[model samples]
Target chain A: MSGTVGLVLVSHSPDLAAGLRELLRQVAGDAVAVTVAGGDDDGGLGTSYELIRDAIAEAGSGAGVIVLPDLGSSVLTAKALLEDHPNPQVRLVDAPFVEGAVAAAVIAATGADLDTVADAAEEAWHARKL
Target chain B: MPESSELTVVLPAHLHARPAGQIVVTAARFTSTVEIVYGAKVANARGVLALLALGATAGETVTVRATGDDAPAAAEAVATALRTTS
Candidate 1:
């Protein structure tokens, strides 16, 4: 069994989430489980509780799961989903969408623990774009 | 022991998230303190954010330094990873 943690990216645009997943796959390779939950069932630009919940379940590999949300409602939706399911192994990180996903995915691919992976995601805030 | 080497960034994608993440992952494999230096900025090689912040693009040159019991191996690993990233 793999001890590597998984990642879930939540965004208002399905394309944004899918793009991030693809980028992360390139960085972390197939060793890390990356799943995306974006847009509503109708493919509109909005968050859905069901989509987030399903992503959480799919991304978890029995080690742990870290969720990165893009903006306002996506974070709220993930929070609500966690409130309903309440898994201790899951974390919703408040960080930049793209940077955090890449950072977290790399850390997770290294087989770091949940908190370490979340910290790596949060560290993305310190990244300088200059 | 502290060891250092200079390697040119040959990746077409430069030090973007993918290659930078790969460098960070490789650097983390060692017990040494790895640092990548580009121009005036130096980044902790073990952190993807710091690595990406270095802004070392393709065709640019970067210095990789490591310090610890495994500095030699760590430096070699980091330099090789950067040199071979495509």
Candidate 2:
């Protein structure tokens, strides 16, 4: 939690979130705080508001938190949490899940500010897989 | 300003997400404007998306160009990052 910008990955699948965490650890190292908020309370394929909220709080180290969601409900859950909590340091990025996570993780690990990390996450939207 | 260097990517996995992310991080450290030229494609070194778009594979040669006060260091650092296997 001492890093510049922490990350919360929201997904419908726990394995996807865990795999992405491992991938981010390999790319960005251990400097940034990466928390996973995937699946529902029952460990099913759904987004959990409590999980997202808890992850944002856990990952935040005073600098900021960037949340990346995989799909529809995940995004809605994260946005809903933001609306209810209204934390200025939190950002919900509309970006590709894996790519955005990697990009943001690398930038955040460098001790970048919240806006910079958010920008890096958004930039992943233009990533060309072809 | 305007320093350039050619580097061969030696990573067995090529310029995948991890290495491309590393390159972006390394290039972002300098104040220089860095770019990676692979064949006909030119990618912004500071952007992970652009770097990944280059599709630079292992053993492929790419040119690193930079223009700023830290151009030299930027070019060298980017080159080193590309040349690194891990």
Q: Work out the TM-score per prediction.
A: 0.91, 0.90
What C-alpha lDDT, on a 0 to 100 scale, does residue A128 get in candidate 2?
A: 79
Report per-candidate TM-score of chain A alone. 0.95, 0.95
- Scored by lDDT, model 1 comes in at 0.86
lDDT of 1 at B18: 75
- The per-model lDDT (C-alpha) reads 0.86, 0.85
Question: Which is the leading candidate under lDDT?
Answer: 1
User: In model 1 chain A, where is the ten-residue run with the lowest total lDDT?
Assistant: A1-10
Pairs of residues at least 3 apart in sequence or in different chains that clash in candidate 2: none
Put down candidate 2 lDDT per residue, A1-130, tens digits, no spaces.
Answer: 4557999999999889999999999888888899999899889989999999889989988898999999989999899889988978899998889889988988887778999999989988777776
What proportion of the true contacts does each candidate reproduce? 0.74, 0.48
Cα displacement (angstroms), candidate 1, residue B61, comes to 2.3
